[model samples]
Target: MISKRPVHVHEAVPHGDEPPGCTSRVSVEVGGRVWLLDREADMEALWERMGEDDLGADERLPYWAEVWPASVLLGRHILRNAEVLCGRMCLDLGCGLGLTGIIASHVGARVVAFDYEWPAVRFARHNAALNNVPQPLWTLMDWREPAVRAHGFDFVWGGDVLYEKRFFDPLIRLFRHVLAPGGKIWIGEPVRTVSRPVWELVRREGFTAELLTVEKVALCGQNATVNLWEVTIS
Candidate 1:
């Protein structure tokens, strides 16, 4: 079941040195526009806390709470093509810190940002507020849910969501279900072995697929290449 309730981080007596909701401010520049994002200050500490709190496998790791390089590239791409977003209804699938949806909202698109993790949804909301962008509808939802399929999105954006081969089929099914007529899906993925088969499946599904751009991005102090792909049903 999908929950629309927003989670708040309350300060309780800490089991360790750092309490929950510890965050740092990060400024990102995309196409001459700047967005300020708030992220967990220490991911390792957060992970430990998650373990203490007995979060499940998906929630135990705070991977969704950090800003990823692919997200940065996707934000840049959205800002570069801002005009296309005006008056569009967009979806940010598995939005981590909500950078892509925030950029889409900044560019005048009506956006719905979704993540399966409640903490991630909270952080995404906080990031939107931090940047002074209009808050998109933040929902804690799994991609395979019937609620997710109910929305007709004109453009669906995701970053670094193609890393696991196990999720490819579900992701593709969700994309096909949510996309409106004449809609497009934009994905920014780091070059990985799993990405090839996913792309091939997308092609076999009769979508017109193309590699829109490839650029080097700095991730965790290391340079990596990110490829942006555009897909539409033919």
Candidate 2:
């Protein structure tokens, strides 16, 4: 179990009312160290909240509630190549739970992390403070219509962000606008059929895309192969 959330969290809900929601704290191991992360305790309930709150079409589901293996893979890779991240200006694009950004900040990088969903940003900020590391400047921003320009990031990275084709253009726009000259974008995702076209799209956009590594990780109650894709301006 990759730090499984407890089946039942906190005190019970009273009779004839909505089930109480909670922030489930799980201890996660990243780069040979234990860090505490707080996540929404019930995902299905969170999805219902998304619908009730009108959280936009992009957030059709509460994908940010769990600690994805892709994020864990990125965290480990950052430790393995700490030299590349140290003192670098990095952006944790679409950062959920802020694991990658937190680790980057821990290893001495100046990081800016953002998520479209406010709940995700809230928990990421909480987790960073819980870990007692240097906090990232968390922003609630939409990639499609960014309120502020994220200029000059040496590295722009995200985990499991290539699942949808609709975001390919905006992602490229971010890379072109925010990434510094000779900057790199690393995205981590489990091998899924839907993600196959993203590689071709990367080349079509004139960026050099390569398989940085294939990390074998346990994800969603199964063993999965996570492809760490690195893209850069050609």
Candidate 3:
């Protein structure tokens, strides 16, 4: 995995719960390395007790669970198979905490990491520093819009970003737009049977798709099943 880079820490928020809620911490492992994050607290409080708590923005998100299957696969694949990433230009999309991008950077890929949520974006940047990876280009972006500023990435990655069927189309559209021809798009998602249509669409769009070996992913210390998606861009 990438070496930890120096973090540009933001001013810490007041140490108390506010309007929506407080912040919790989650440690996402990419490859064998782990990153600690102070994230916006969820109503369930799954990650709140992991460590010290801090307050931050609490905008409702579609998927706010502590453990994610997709991220595990992305991390494992790149870490266990470093040759897939040597010297590649990569994008880590919907990069909650930036684990996948961090792993890519560690393996010598030049990476750009992005997420829409400020808290997640902040954590992503911090994780890059925490893991001692090369400083990745970071950005606040809505993948649904035209990403005119970023182009020609050899690889694009996302994990567990397909929970809502409504967002799948636009997400796939953005993947098609950002990846260089002959590049790769890898996504890790749990077996949400509803995602079959999106998989079919990816295949129809001329990208080759395959499922990786399913594995038990650790989240907040518990185990969960995760599936991997490897998309070969034409």
Ranked by lDDT from best down, the candidates are 1, 2, 3
Worst 10 residues of 2 by lDDT: 1-10
Off by over 4 Å in 1: 1-20, 52-60, 149-151
Which lDDT values do the candidates have, in the order given?
0.73, 0.73, 0.64
lDDT by residue for model 2 over 1-234, one digit each (tens)?
111111111121122222124457767688779878777764666656555445443344666677788888888888887888899888887677778888998999988887765566667777787788887877666666655456678888888887777777777886778878888888888889888887888798889999999988764567768999888988
TM-score for all predictions?
A: 0.85, 0.85, 0.75
Steric clash pairs (candidate 3): 2-106, 3-131, 3-132, 3-133, 4-131, 4-132, 4-133, 5-129, 5-132, 70-188
Over 4 Å off, model 2: 1-22, 48-55, 148-151, 219-221
- Considering only N, C-alpha and C atoms within 3 Å, which residue pairs clash in candidate 1? none
**Per-residue lDDT tens digits of candidate 3, residues 1-234?**
111111223232222312133256666655555665444554255344443333233223423233355676778887876786888888887666567777778888888776664555555666566667786776656676645344588888787776667767787687778888778788787777777788888778777888867787766666777788888865
Candidate 1 lDDT, tens digit per residue, 1-234? 011111222221112222137367667666676777676654566666654456544444566766777888998888887899888889887777778889899999999887766667677777777788887887667665626544488998888887777668877887888899999899988888878888889888878889999998764577879899998988
Considering summed lDDT, which 10 consecutive residues are worst modelled in model 3? 1-10
Candidate achieving higher lDDT, 2 or 3:
2
Which residue ranges in model 3 land beyond 4 Å of their true spot?
Answer: 1-25, 28-30, 40-67, 148-151
